[model samples]
Target: MQDKTNNQESSLTRRDFIKTAAIGAGAAAIVSMSLTEGQSQTQPAEAPKTQPSATPLKLEDVLKKAREKLYPRCRVCPECDGRACSGEVPGMGGIGSGKSFHNNYDSLAKIQLKMKTFHDVKKPDTSITLWGHKLAVPILSAATGGVTYNMGLKGKMTDEEYIDALLGGCIKAGTIGMAADGIGDPLDIYEIRLKAVAKYNGKAIATIKPKTQEEIIKRIRMIEKAGGLAFAVDIDSAGRAARALPGQTVEPKTMKQLKELAQCTKLPFIIKGIMTVEEAEMAVECGAAGIVVSNHGGRVLDHTPGSADVLAPIADKVKGKIVIFVDGGIRYGADVLKMLALGADAVLVGRPLLRGAVGGGQDGVALLINKMKNELVDSMVLTGTADVKKVKRDILIV
Candidate 1:
């Protein structure tokens, strides 16, 4: 492969190399952002355009471009259920059998929506006010990184380019994006990621891996400096310790440590990775302002229950105590409604937006989000739901 580098460069793109490596490694399929608190009274920074073109970009066009760029790194499959790229970790897919990822898709698929058009609900309000920041939609971009290795875009896209498109697109759509800290990322690279968060002027969230208390605190300080609205520790990343790069450490945090981390930041400190009622309650007790019920998109473990399956129970236990955000298999606008009915305050979407960034840049990301929002509107109208903040449980047949 090294000897053919020059020859391949003449005729091949990074996407092609990623496809070649996937075949050599034996893979069937592969696949698959906001704001600050406190301080300033200054006006927010303006968001950059998705592209310079004046012509409106279609969602299908974005997906086509993403499919070309992502190729085997992700098939940009119609379903995106982790089946095609089952064991393609360090690339896309999930860990081990990919059962957890499959469960995420299946669980959401099993949820049936009830269409009630008789009521006089023409326009459904999709806006949400999360922690005093009002948003156009309940959907926010999930924090994702490692574009060079994980997504195989080394030569084609830089981390900065990918994140800029991700955050910029979300901001343009009147929502927020997340900035991620890869387990292998050094402090300098993390600082670079924070710059994207800063560029949005406190309209993005920064997610940290479950490193030591000191490390988490240090990064929190940095995020505060960047005008980040909130920060989260993906405690599920603790399971990836064996896979972590040398000199990097990730460990599960005790309640005591979590409290310290929460108190360390004036910004709303979120604890991501809660999958059960017990832990959800614990998060509330630990002073977490918010909790993201995730399983790291099913990437850290195998055979786990889907986020949707586990969400309702957790929400039942601690719904009003902490802000709830769930991510896993949320594809369309109705999926967003189902989650709201399941008791989530809002939802986070992954994978699809990544495809947008890879295939069409900022505009692609915004188009995809707006498409979901429109779908959400249709869903609300069909279900006689007037507001996103108060979706009824009867809207879903479960």
Candidate 2:
């Protein structure tokens, strides 16, 4: 039998069932809805509002608004795992097959939390200090941009507006955000994001693509002038060199080039795409102050392991040698605890935070972070974990 809600449309697609599966069996009532071009861009469609409870219902409102704002480009699905929009690169899904993206979600989900209630662990400390800035939570916004083509929000939202929402929201939440470097962006577009970073002087991170050494150094100088607390080079973007527009080039960096980039800046230099123990070791050898275990959210690769799948081994090899951070499929505070127990100094959240920004602006972003902060505190209390900075490995049944 056909579903009545999808009046004029056919039965639900694989993506729709995937969404239901991720949320729960009951989420079938909230099947994905397709919007016309006119409605997709202009009107805000009503989505299912989450049931009110002790947990804040604000995120559902934010997701509903974001779904309207980012329709077609992103369904803002019940689950943000790559399943619903797998293999969509220009838009929001991962690269070919999206196996890498799926890995991120599966790897984290496979680890079971060992809950303990027989302890006096009240008021867990969810704070951590990164480069002298004390954060209310161990979360930061990963560098993300390309709002126009990537998010289909060109006319609806400008690049500056998006960056402001991200950086400003992170600051409001007592954490930090990273401004991205779009492969096809013009010099002016890049400068505008830097200005946003400068707006939060010494509180934000600026990320550059894996362009040439000269080009990388040039942007580092600009980041320094912007008073950025740190700068990162997403070496994983090297895979998209062919997609780069003329005059904007990307390439893999050699150890010599990496060292030069690290020494050229007074700010902390982070290498943002280390996925292996060998590469993690090389990042330390290159004098990087930090390394983000990522696969560009599985956007740049097809069959790579999830950051969660590889984080512990990499962390075991270089956890204290350099600050270790992980990103990819981190959607909740429980996931944050799992990553910490597996060995991560902190976690970087991408898509959900992006939804918060696109859907609810700065306040939306702050609300999302604050919600996760509360969840993190609760998770810590139940697991006998006392602090974000000192999470133990025994808290998980991996």
Candidate 3:
């Protein structure tokens, strides 16, 4: 809830935050040069360090578009940082109490990096392979839908157009995209998304609600026919029973059902919306290919800890065996680095990208991803991290 105050402290922009960090890094480099001035002649000469005012990233321009397109409708606040939009899940805010929303941001902020001045820091390798295809960054778009109902962007664009823009952006950026389905959505509307995913040649993923086995399987068959690379079911959607469609219901999967569902697909089976180590273990037992440490962007449950708060423990319980990804309060590239250090193969971003699609369409999404990639590299260089895959616990000041 301190986003306004914190964003003010961010000096009005994300660039300013990176600028300050860069300046501190420059200062550290200068001190290191001073101490090693007369070291062994075999050492390669290094450039002198002086603080350079970092320039604003080109991505900032997209926010200008977002401001015009969003705002009044979504606000597109100075910072996409969670506070302004908590407790409004059905319309872009977190679920009741907003505590879960605040926790994701708070826990990530509490994790400070142990930056080093002397070491072999290479260009950060931000690439990762998800479900067999390589991506430029270890990031994915969180499955989100209902621009009219959820984003309040009525009259701005239709649902089909919105899905196209988001998915197109991700694929163009050399990464995968996620297309979401809602229980209230008509079957035809859901199939429209399936066609879009197929157009991307199976690079896009499909997400289903936790509906009855027959309905869920029917949808899965459709997704596979569409050439989706993988599929997931947001179990958190089960809590929205009041919103269930007539003749349709959503419920949590029993272990038996989960195993059967996993068997239903040759593509990777991902179980999203998991928050407990026990549930995470259950996912493994059910033959899941991945598990997303999410609290449904804090939109499904109230009074729960943020995904970041529980991720470390869940990750400790199941790390290499399952592709672990996390998604709440992930507004920055530094947050991506933090999650990877804590134990995540990748991270997903939600609201900001929605704004990106709303404002600049595919271009905006690519710009946002490129910006996060740059910021991740910057943070890695400052911390002397050479590789993302081998990120160590020592990097955390803890």
Best-to-worst TM-score order:
2, 1, 3
Clashing pairs in 3: 88-93, 89-93
lDDT of each: 0.83, 0.83, 0.77
Q: Which candidate, 2 or 3, has the higher lDDT?
A: 2
Q: lDDT tens string, model 2, 108-211?
A: 99999999999999978777888887787888998888899899997899999999999987876778898999888887898999999888875888999888
Worst 10 residues of 1 by lDDT: 34-43
Cα lDDT for residue 323, candidate 2: 87
lDDT, candidate 3, 118-204, per-residue tens: 987867677787867878788789888887777766787788888887888776556778999877888988998998899888788
Residues 67-152, candidate 1: write the lDDT tens digits.
66676678777678998778888878888999998999888999999989899998677788887887889889999888877898
Q: Which residue ranges in model 3 land beyond 4 Å of their true spot?
A: 1-58
Q: In model 2, what is the error at residue 51, expressed in angstroms?
A: 27
TM-score of each: 0.87, 0.87, 0.84
List ranges where model 2 is wrong by over 4 Å: 1-11, 14-57
What does candidate 1 score in Cα RMSD to the true structure? 8.6
RMSD of every prediction:
8.6, 7.9, 10.6
